[model samples]
Target: MSSLSGRTAVAGIGATEFSKKSGRSELRLAAEAVHAALDDAGLSPADVDGMVTYTQDANQEIAVAREVGIGDLSFFSRVHYGGGAACGTVLHAAMAVATGVAGTVVCYRAFNERSGRRFGQPDARLGGEPSSQGLEMSWHVPYGLMTPAAWVAMFARRYMHAYGATSEDFGRVAVAMRRHAATNPAAWFHGRPITLEEHQASRWIVEPLHLLDCCQESDGAVALVVTSAERARDLRRSPAVIRAAAQGSGAGQMMMTSYYRDDMTGLPEMGVVGRRLWEQAGLGPSDVQAAILYDHFTPFVLTQLEELGFCGRGEARDYVAGGGIEIDGRLPVNPHGGQLGEAYIHGMNGIAEAVRQIRGTSVNQVRDVRNVLVTAGTGVPTSGLVLSAG
Candidate 1:
């Protein structure tokens, strides 16, 4: 087995309040979140020597390090593909620490997506410039596939068809998320849980996709502190050991829309990550006591359950027919409300929740969260990690 397995752990996780508007620069959010994570780990900025984030992150590593008063950075890296890059950030940081490239590493993502950039809006380009993404947009945007919701709807429709799922099945995911959010004080939707009836009654954003099915477009930042497994024992909190981390890209993958694939009902990339995770961790799906499956769209949650071997293909609907994803279910999912009801920190928040579960600190804490499986965005090349109590 590689030294990477059980070599590093996420000793600290911190995030800002999930909100519609942060009312601050993304750089400041990034710096604040990094500082919070360091504090949570009982470390200071001076202790950090490595940083990792998404390629789309505006705050550069050097800039964040300087703002946070870190002396120097020996390692820094960026992952791509929007929300799919969340877990990959920690993977790179863990590798850095496991290999002695850096003593202490921080993985973070901060964005004023809702207030500043407004990712929900359909723009001609990311920054009104022409590039490869622009080329892809050119083909779809002109055909009414402009917004993220519209793009994800195509796959959601296909998933519903292939699995014989109803709109109410998707509503169950939203209801569970809102229930978790209702209890989480840091959640923007705190004390605002919704019922399945409410979810079904919500207006439709796209055909076969209700408004509640889509994830929130909020502004916030989340960070994780990574270090060697030995050092993590000295940290402030119990370590959430990085049992396994893997990133995978399927054949003919695209940004949000990968319509050309032969199999559109499942996320093949997640399957790749899942197989490697289970192998590296020496644990199967049965060993996972809880999960934080990415919920960029409610349908993707069901598809992920199938792809990650939690259930058979086209059986996620029956698997989730009851309130199985709730706190007392067979496998509690999105115990932190997820991006659907909490806030979308580009899937970084989901990783934080997984750490909370392992540490037995989640508001909707499962009875015995020995191992928690966390995944990044779906319908694209994705990433996953298996976290265990250290």
Candidate 2:
């Protein structure tokens, strides 16, 4: 295992209520979550000296530090690539704590994705800008491949063609996530589990993709406290040890438009992350008690299972169809409802769920959970974590 493995731990986690509208500024949401995390850790803002967040997050680290009553920070950093940066933020905090550059770090993400700026809508300005990202978007926007759903549909269609996978295969993922969510009171879709028939009948957002397959746009924030493993042992809650955290970008990666790769059916970037995580943690797929796979789109969840070596390539449809991913099955996934049934806080909530499982406090707690796997966004430069009990 890497020297960084199990050196630091997530001692606390906190989140705001998931909703379509938070009725507050993103900064305030960030502060509230941070404060709650500190409180959960039995630490005050005065103890925090490091901060990290997504580069695209509207709330700046310094701004959040000030609002939360934190003093001078020794470490503050940000990761790029939208939802792919979720676990990467925790990676940064673990590195800081392990290296003694910072004593305690708080990783957070906050946004008003629903009421303020709906990411589902196409923005024409993305293609007109002069930056490299804009140049990349220019390759597809003019051809009506502007929205995220359209971009993912291209890959989903290819996946279906390559593996003979049907839309029902994808619907199975939604159904499983909703079933777990229905039992989680914190989930937005609590008490609203759907059947396979319901998933099949949901409105189509794009070919091979349904509205139910897409995650909800939510307004909220989630924050986690990271500190040395030894110190974490004395914290208020059971610490979720940082067994491994890694980020990976595959060849020909172009944000979410990584269509140039030879195999559109797989996410090579997540494969890279999975390899590193397993090596670092000295554990394999069977060791994981549960998983919080990023569920931005159901098709990607199937792809992630293959990339993570939970099953062979082109076999996830059968793997999911045979009750392989249920709460009582081989690998229960998204027990907190995931981004689909739960509100999407850009994967931050998913990380919190991983911590909850480790602490034996998850709403849908799996029996004898000692290790939980959490993945970030796919079809982009992505990240993942192997969180184990301390």
Candidate 3:
């Protein structure tokens, strides 16, 4: 077993209301979310000596620290890539707490993705900086591979062609996520579930990706508090132990559009993440009670299941069919509606849902949630975590 397993735990989680527009600055949103998380953990800002956040996050670590009244920070770090860095923030924080690098750590992501600068639009900010990412974008952006949807569409199309997967099969994922969202009070899609037929009829953004299959362009923030296992016992909420945390970047990995791989049908980076997670946690697919697979797009969720070994390769379409991901089904995924249904606070919302499951406080509660699996974005260098009830 990994030494870090059960050494650290998540004592708190907090978020603002999910919305299309926050009407506030990104820095303000970050500060508000940080304070709320500290409240949930029964921790004062002075208790936080460590901070972690996404590299794409608009609010810097020092900026958030000062705004939240944190006096001195011993550990501060940032993980890169867009939504892929969501779970990684927690992983970094957990490691800091586990290894005695810091006492209490907070991982956060905040942005005005919708009302401010949008990631979906073609970025004019790439001024050819002398960086690896700038180099990768240079080859594709000029060729009109400008947006995330278009980058993922290339693989989605190839997966469909190779496995005979249909757009309707992809729609089933959208239907299930929306169904779960309908009952979640905090979900933006509360009481607004869509049917399978509606998914089929939705307008096409790309050739096999319907508009309904895509996640929302939400603007918000989320935060999580990680501390030692001993300290979590005295916290406000039931602690979700960090059973395992891992980040992986595969061979020949590029940005969202890594078409040069030996097989374009798979995400090797996520497979790399899955291997370390199961090995470190000493658990398999059967031990997991639920999951919060990243759902930036519906098709990627299916791929994540296969990559993470929840199901065999090319079998996710069938695995997810027949109510497989519903509350009463085999492995309930995204019980809090996920990015497709919940507000897209990046993948941090998914991590919060996993914590709720272990705490036995989720709206769509599952029985015997001893272990919960959570993953970040699929396309690029990715990350995963196994959260469990201590």
Candidates' C-alpha lDDT: 0.88, 0.92, 0.90
lDDT per residue, candidate 1, 210-249, as tens digits?
9999988899999999999899998899999999998989
Candidates by TM-score, descending order: 2, 3, 1
Residue ranges of candidate 1 with Cα displaced over 4 Å: 126-131
Clashes of 3: 0
Kindly indicate the candidate among 1 and 3 with the higher lDDT. Answer: 3
Candidate 1 positional error at 94, Å = 1.0
Question: What TM-score should be assigned to candidate 1?
Answer: 0.97
In candidate 3, list every pair of residues with a backbone clash.
Answer: none
Candidate 2 per-residue lDDT over residues 1-390, each given as its tens digit: 237899999998989999998999999999999998999999999999999999989999999998999999999999999899999999999999999999999999999999899888989787998699999999999988887787888899999999999999998898888888899998889999999899889899988798888888999999999999999999899999999999999999998899888889999999999999999999999999999899999999999999999999999999999667878878999888899998899999999999999999988899999999999988778899999997
* Pairs clashing within candidate 1: none
Candidate 3 lDDT over 1-390, as tens digits, reads: 337788899999988888888999999999988998899889999999999999888789999999999989999999987778987988899889878899999999888788888777888655377587788788888777788888898999999998888898888888888999999999989999999999999998877788998998888899999999889988888899999999988988988988988998889999998999999899999999999999999888889989999888899999888989877789999999999998888899899899999999999888889999999987988899999998
What's the CA RMSD for each of the models? Answer: 1.4, 1.0, 1.2
lDDT, residue 379, model 1: 70
Stretches of candidate 2 off by over 4 Å are none
